[model samples]
Target: MITPTSDRGTKQVHDGQDFVEFTRTFRAPAEDVWAAVTDPGRLARWIGSWRGDPADGEVWFRMLFEGDEIPEEHMAIHQCDAPHRLRVTSTSPSEEGPQVWDFRIDLVEANGVTTLTFAQSVPDAQLAEGVGPGWQYYLDRLMLAETGADPADIDFDDYYPALKEHYRELFA
Candidate 1:
């Protein structure tokens, strides 16, 4: 069951900069979760697919968040640490020069369960409220794909304004 955003715990961290972190514990193994994240084939099921070797350093890839109508956003793989962490940074071209955000995915296993920590940091702190629900929904898709659930189709309407309001209230 999907819990209400009001009930979920999200924290803001600052190491001289701001970061929004979301945590989820899966009853699956760490390696399994890691594979789902690292493999482009599996990632396509939830978020967009990648086509690069992170080991070789910053590799560029296209991101597809919405359907075919939306243009793919060019993103780059910033870092990859196997079944432990995956870091990515993306710059969106705009008249304002470029908008950038860093995504960090960290995984750890203990007592047969794996815990995934997903975080996103940007220069503007206000962005977190808008991003909170988006990441939650994507992670939910990750859980569905990992658990062998049936064909999963994510609806943006189910998350956006709904959780966005919650995030705004909480972060405000």
Candidate 2:
């Protein structure tokens, strides 16, 4: 149900059972895109604060989504490979559910261009519907920041509400 903003397209999968996937092609090299996503310092510039080193079996800092100051204790890093792929696992603490969010980031290089594919698979329908727009916004910001440009200052607190409404209107 993600409302299309600025011609940025979105797609839904699995009757809302599978996680919403967002893909964008960045005009940067695959190495640079991968670094921006996997490198803690680079990631913080675009996304949020990241703690601990990124490695296999290492619990990196929880991503402070949009408005929340306290990182969710239920988040963790599952796997990471430089300039290629990363997988993260996240859970919702508000519910007594065992659902895990599997985020897979893949980088494809061809003809001096890079396509960054971000796929987040959540088991819950509600979460999937809500997360679609959030990821789109953040990834848009990430692309801008990587290109040595300042993205419009976005208030993280307003992200969820706007996205939720957008999703409902688009997919309703």
Candidate 3:
């Protein structure tokens, strides 16, 4: 079990915009880790899935939950270096209005271990309380997938409201 209080760090980026960064190391090769992150089938096992054409300059991103239903949005891929780095931007409707957010993913290898780094700018500081653990759970799911664990074994309840307080304290 992962301690809710660990595995994540917060930062202020560019004019005090708050963001959260997460890093996880996989015992697999960088190529294998990259496939797990970018491949739609593998991603659906962990976080969300994509549907749009990348050559078209955009793609459809669907956020998969515990059920068949999902919430999706369009994301523009600003840059991608297969198996290494990706930068993307997307806007989604929120109670606070349409929010544009940035996401970056990086993979690096050294001495036979591969590390995955993820960073995203928070649209609202208060949301950090939820975002932190949400990503943590997803990354954990990714680990389970790469290890051949069943995705059905994952329970979203363990992340969201369950670990909300732990993340809230981090944001606080």
Candidate 4:
């Protein structure tokens, strides 16, 4: 059974931009957590995999969980500090037009536990309704993946509608 309290994200404003953030702590080290989020092969175990070199400041990411019909997303790496921090902008196509998302990940370790903070800058509460639950689901999968557990065990249905109101209230 999935716990209702699994949603621990918060909404915040930084530098005049609104953001929805989620934080997860792992007993593993920062390096392991970092690899889970950055390494293409490791990421494939949870969310998605990427191609192209990050040193080029961009990569193409194809989500493995979403099936093969979805197009690959283009991500521009703004900042990357191995095993610690990462900032990127993701651009994808939508019915309205091109959608761009700004994301930031930061990690801190102390006495073996590594804490990862994931944030996405959003324009409004409407956007966060989906973004919040989506990230919560993905981050939970990430936690499972790092522990060698099957991330596939998690269902997207557990997140979306269940937490949509929660996110709407937070951003509203």
Candidate 5:
């Protein structure tokens, strides 16, 4: 479950595109934090794992922590600047049809601390209700993973529904 101390994301517009953004800080260096997000092995500890060479600008990502029937998402890397920024687009099967998602991750180091900013473009506020908390859960899990703690200790139930209204209000 998420504690009151856990931070929530904000809604913003960049170039007229709606996005939900979250920020996380790590005592580690920028390169270390960057590897935690980009490296397939490190990612598997928190969010998910990926296959295929990133140099190919594409990879099949699987969300290991989600559920049993984990589907591989086709992620296309749009831009990659090591230890700083990464932009990617992913296509996943949705109830309506194939859903395309745009995600961005940026990292900056100051005073030996790395600040990681993550953003995902959303089509509407309704979607952000769920997406916001979902990312919060994963990002929190990432924190645990980075500290060598079990990410599974964080529950999704504490995020959704409970924090849904907070995110929905961002649009209002």
Candidate 6:
């Protein structure tokens, strides 16, 4: 069971055609959250296991979603600010040609609350649909992991399929 936190945030779908844009809010400070996302040590606690620095023009390693057993290809950091924004370019392997996935993250603070907005442009509709809940799961975990809590307690299997269907219904 997923117990929603008092500091919980929402994710909104911004575009449906060729990409998916998501915006979520967090209760932590921008700097702390940014470090949690950009720092390899901190990021491994929540998101997929990664390697290499998060500096601009750098390529990093990203493992698959299921576990760290299978390592994916490199993801290049296109642009980044210390605690404000980041842009990256990655390729997702598939039956067809690898699809390019461009991601942009913006950290905004208002009245002591920080909002992290993630915008992604995928090359295919199927990929965009799949990424919706996958991000939701990680972002929620990111929030919990930042607070010294274990985020692996929640089950994401059900939510992931449902989110993909929801995206299809909404965008179709």
| C-alpha TM-scores of all predictions | 0.82, 0.73, 0.84, 0.95, 0.95, 0.80
List the pairs of residues colliding in candidate 3: none
TM-score of model 4 (CA atoms): 0.95
Quote the lDDT for 24 in model 6.
Answer: 64
What does the lDDT read for residue 68 in candidate 3?
A: 60
Candidate 6, residue 40: the lDDT equals 72
Candidate 4 collision pairs: none
Q: Candidate 2's C-alpha lDDT?
A: 0.64
State the C-alpha lDDT per candidate: 0.70, 0.64, 0.76, 0.88, 0.88, 0.67
62-150, model 5: which lDDT tens digit per residue?
99987878678999999999989999999998779988889999999999999999999888879889989889889999998898888
Model 1 residue 98 CA deviation in Å? 1.4
Off by over 4 Å in 1: 1-9, 69-78, 151-153
Taking the tens digit of each residue's C-alpha lDDT, what string does model 2 give over 87-138?
A: 7776645446555666778888887788887877755546545676678778
The alpha-carbon RMSD values of the candidates against the true structure, listed in the order shown, are: 2.8, 4.5, 2.7, 1.3, 1.3, 3.5
Instruction: Encode model 4's per-residue lDDT on 1-172: one tens digit a residue.
Output: 4443365689887668899998999998999889889989899999899999998999999899988888888999999999899999999988899899889999999999998999999898898899899899999888888887788787889888988998888889
lDDT of 2 at 80: 71
Model 3, span 29-74: residue lDDT tens: 8888988987898888878888978887789888886456544777
Number of the candidate with higher lDDT, 2 or 5: 5
Return whichever of 1 and 5 wins on TM-score. 5
- Candidate 3 deviant stretches above 4 angstroms: 1-6, 12-16, 66-69
